[model samples]
Target: MNDSAIDYAAVFQALPGMVALLTPGLVIADVNEEFLRAAGRKREQVVGRLLFDVFPENPNDPAATGMRNLKASLQRVMATGERDAMALQRYDVEDPERPGHWQERYWSPCNAPVLDPGGEVVLLVHRVEEVTELIRARGGRSTGRAQGLEAELYSRARELQELNERLRRAHAREREVALALQEAMLPASRQVGNHRAAVRYRPAVGALNVCGDWYDLVDLVGGHRLGVSVGDVVGHGLAAAGVMGQLRSALSATSRVADGPAQALDVLGRYAHVVDGAESATAVTTFIDFDRHTITYSSAGHPPPVLVHPDGRVEFLDRATDPPLDARPDPIRRPEAGTAFTGGATLALYTDGLVERRREDIDTGLARLADSLRRHRAADPETLADAVLLELLPPGGATDDTALIIVRL
Candidate 1:
């Protein structure tokens, strides 16, 4: 047999799906027997005719613009030399040979560019799959009750709910993992250059899994200059946790750039003020300069730090002179040096929840904190921090979150 005398019958008989060839203009050049049977048309009727002419009424009738869009997509395929696929398109055509019989047709384009002997684009080949039986099986009939419909429906619904629950658990685990990473990055140990230091942290029990209470000790350029900070984010959960980390990191970075405590807190407050909305709610921050014997602090609705002396006397540090970060355009108020202490001094910074009780007043909580520090004056900063947690925090635990940072001079 000559190569020109192609075995078209063998090709169609062996094909796994329907196939067709069309001109760039959408004129049907050639179609397999499957296409003819599915459309209920003779080869003569469809061949040499425009596809839209044969399938006159578009399936997406109400949205007739779909046909135009589909044509535009086909043009993209031709220009990009890429294959294009289409979903099921349904149709019902009356069969001429079988009177009173109707044919269901569904077509999907499997695009290809046929090349001539010179490798030039000759025609576009679309291996269309006529999934009539599949469409019929998927389509719901007007009548006939399914077997165990209620039980089957219940089983599918339960499966869907189970899948959704698994997704929620996976998302929660991801959040927990992220929070754990942030906690790890926080300052677990305390150090102020050559000076000995210690820290204690206790997460609020009743609060959300994560709290915004965070503290940091940054080693400044000169061993004499150290940065101390304690802050509380507005809310609980991952958003607050993330923002707390950002503010802490920003404070650390800003301290390196600024020369003094007041300048550092001022810079951080200015930047935080721009983080408006829920993200930039408020944070109370203080910077201590051990080398120059000066203390600069700022508050964003945060509780004031308690000052403990070696003489066993406790006093609240200079009250905040500025609003919390992001409170206003000029929210920052410079903290000034209040008392000059040379021998040994302790500055205890804490979140509001630590010194505010539901049944008791704010002053009562502050008094309790002071008395606890005075009673445990001999213990190290870490032990003192833990003692305060044990004495002040309720047996059931704090309703709100708590964070504390104690620095000694």
Candidate 2:
């Protein structure tokens, strides 16, 4: 085309949608009014400047990478005298009004080399289309070719949040219900009549709902003879709680007759084994004879009790760690007789969860609990128990129910 016949400025200014013609080095040869206004610049500011000189911060960002690739593609087109259409791309434009947020942008490039009479490249034409609205609707950056993928992602996230909230509320309600049920099953806060008694129940820390571990202190028919019991069933869900309830009821009913700890556990185990028919199931129980100052406690597969003396010296009572009842139809070899307690001391009875977790073995875990108890010897029962539960149990959940009962005699 002859220079005298061609009207270069008129043709570029007339075309729409952010047109820019560039030199080989990405220097702007010419730009349309629409392109100048959209970039928040004037014709004098952009026409002679390189593209990188305007947006220098994002050299490695995807939009910048796309621009570099377009430059390369343009070189190919210029050599072959071919026109090319680019894949869709994105850009992030800083908004002067919004300090931290950005205005997202989408673009597609049209590039061709301008040829002279010798068929040599003299300039490049870049036609850019802004598709920001379309990009925002389909979700940014990602290709959303599949139908409804964006809406599905949004809907699933919303559903997950709603489910999490419902679970939180349900857990709170379950705790309240478990606490009320446990309170009803427990003896009065203050011991009735001549018996001076205290019962402490600490639910497992991080356990979903209040566990089935509970304590009971009832005045048996024999005068001055109170029945002290700490019990835990094998599991942690509602089933375990149900089992605990049955055991407490049965123990209360039978305590009127049985005077021995071993005998009481035997009776409880016999009842549990028969619950689902056959002797396949098991539950653990411990009964203490709190005959005034003398403490004779027995266990059925439960962790040993700790004796915290008035002098702040703590010791774990030793007993034959037998299998939880239901290892056989017969009751476990009666937990060997425990240490005799003198006056002015606290005895702590707890289920295994208080001292055991999935990460560590039972022996090591129990030793840690004993050491923790001894370290906090001066702290009172409630504080000490709470600290141990918070520190020892796993952060999220408990594999078994934990029950703690502390009594000062």
Candidate 3:
């Protein structure tokens, strides 16, 4: 297009950045749409007015240097009849909604004088780039000392982020090792005495720390009897997992010598007092007698075991129980509860983490577990355990380690 047909006024308004023209006397002559938006003013309010009158220095801030610096830059342009660049400046604009309030802003400004044929300054072309967001994002520092402080803060943030990443990796490796150890200690699914026994163990979600929850199904001295145990230690990390390992080992050993669940738990409780960090551990021990068709179980401050009969009848072994292991130097002997079991009956022993939710009461969780067991009573031991876990602790639902054992007789 020819220069005459270009419509320079439209082009000036179409410019993306803020552009404005001022008289040699520093009076506002014309401004682009970007400038109007940035200044939050109408054309009538700013045009033909003195530039300083429209954007006066912030009177409340005695240290404000915006007006002074801007005036000096305009003076330099007028004197030299050449372009002048000003340093980054904080120029606060009056709030359109609130008359007395000033909104903070930052700008990088340049001024170029338009000379007449006599070499005298006629107009000043001003352009500005807004840097308010950038400055605020970089700590909103405007003082001389702000540069050093911002640099220090940025350096420290990077260092902290790197340190956190390293720590996260180290914790992940530790958790992997702990999880391997826990899995190694657990007994695989197999036939024990005339029953099919299966176990399910799920670690807490995002728990880089180890938890003290375990399940074991071991054979007794007589091949007809099977011993099943589920327990939870009080804390987390390597120590809790180690305690769980010790308790599992002790329970397996004691089950061989003790004739009943009550006797085995009593011996285990005594052993707990002697071991460091074994206090307040909760466990449920059960003896499955294949010949007698009975299950004898004892609880030490643990959730009750559930017995699902072949006829879809569910019973929780919620009897009287003693405190958790190592509660005292001489813990009281927990009483054993026995229930008759017919063929095709399933007994589920689980740690509290399987059913106990953080916000819900233990009784509610137990009821939900019982309901789930009743719904899937016909399922095989492994499938039944999986169903219960799916119902009670869905994906990312469990906040603690869960250990469950299902024995089908």
**Please, what is the whole-model Cα lDDT of each candidate in the order they appear?**
0.64, 0.62, 0.81
lDDT of 1 by residue, 319-384 (tens): 654556666665445664445544467778777768875445688788888999888877877787
In order of appearance, the predictions have TM-scores of 0.55, 0.56, 0.65
lDDT of 2 by residue, 1-409 (tens): 7989889788778888888887867789888987877776677878888975653334334324444545556755654555778766554555545545556555667888787765546777888887655434453545546335645544554464456456657877887887777666766545434324445455543354545676677666765666666777655555666777777788767666776666677777778776642133233333444565565555666667777776767777665455665666655546646566666566667777667644347788777777776676556656766766667654423445666665555
TM-score of 1: 0.55
The prediction achieving the highest TM-score against the true structure is: 3
Ranking of candidates on TM-score, top first:
3, 2, 1
- Put down candidate 3 lDDT per residue, 317-392, tens digits, no spaces: 8774668977767566678888899999889999877876543568888889999998998888889989999988
Using TM-score as the yardstick, the better of models 1 and 3 is 3
Instruction: For each candidate in turn, give its C-alpha RMSD to the true structure in angstroms.
Output: 25.6, 21.9, 23.1
Best by lDDT: 3
Residue 130 of model 3, lDDT score = 86
Clashes of each: 2, 0, 0
